[model samples]
Target: MGLRMASGKLRQSFRIYEWLDSHKISVTSIAESIAITPSMVSHTIRGRKNNRRVLKKLVDLGCPQEFLSLPIDLEKQVAA
Candidate 1:
C-alpha cells in the first residue's frame, strides 16, 4: 500500500500555497508560473495527484530547498 490522500481534495496546508491564497494570488498565477494550466493546478491541489508536485514548484518559485524539510503542520495550514 502507498500513502493515500483523499481523492480530489486540495492539500492546501502547504504554507506557500496558504500564504499565496491568503494574499489572494489567483490559482491561474501559480499555474502560469509553474508552466501548468489553472485546471491542472486545481487538480494537483485537490489531491487528485497524490504525488504532490508543489515542492518542486516551491523550488521554482525561489523557495529554498532546505525549507522543503520544514514541518508543514498540514492540519493547520490546510485548514487556513
Candidate 2:
C-alpha cells in the first residue's frame, strides 16, 4: 500500500522481535535457520541491522510480508 523498500529490510517498530521474545525464539535459532550469524540477528533485533537476505529468510519462516513493508501497523498484523 506504500512505497516499501525493495530490499524488505526489517524495521524495529514492526515488533517482530517482540513476537520472537514472546515465543522464546532465540536469535541464534533464527540465524541458524537462515544461515546467517547470530550477531546479525541480534543487531536486527536491536534495530541496527538490515539485510535483504535475512528479511527474505525470515519471511519464508513465517514473518508477515507486512513487516517488510513501509508504514507497518502492528494492530493489523494477522495472528500467528
Candidate that scores best on TM-score: 2
lDDT of 1 by residue, 15-54 (tens): 5466556667667887787677787766555455533355
Candidate 1 lDDT at 71 equals 28
Query: What stretches of model 2 exceed 4 Å from their correct place?
Result: 1-10, 69-80
TM-score of 2: 0.55
The local lDDT score (0 to 100) that residue 65 gets in candidate 1 is: 34
lDDT of 1: 0.52
Clashes of each: 4, 0
TM-score, every prediction: 0.44, 0.55
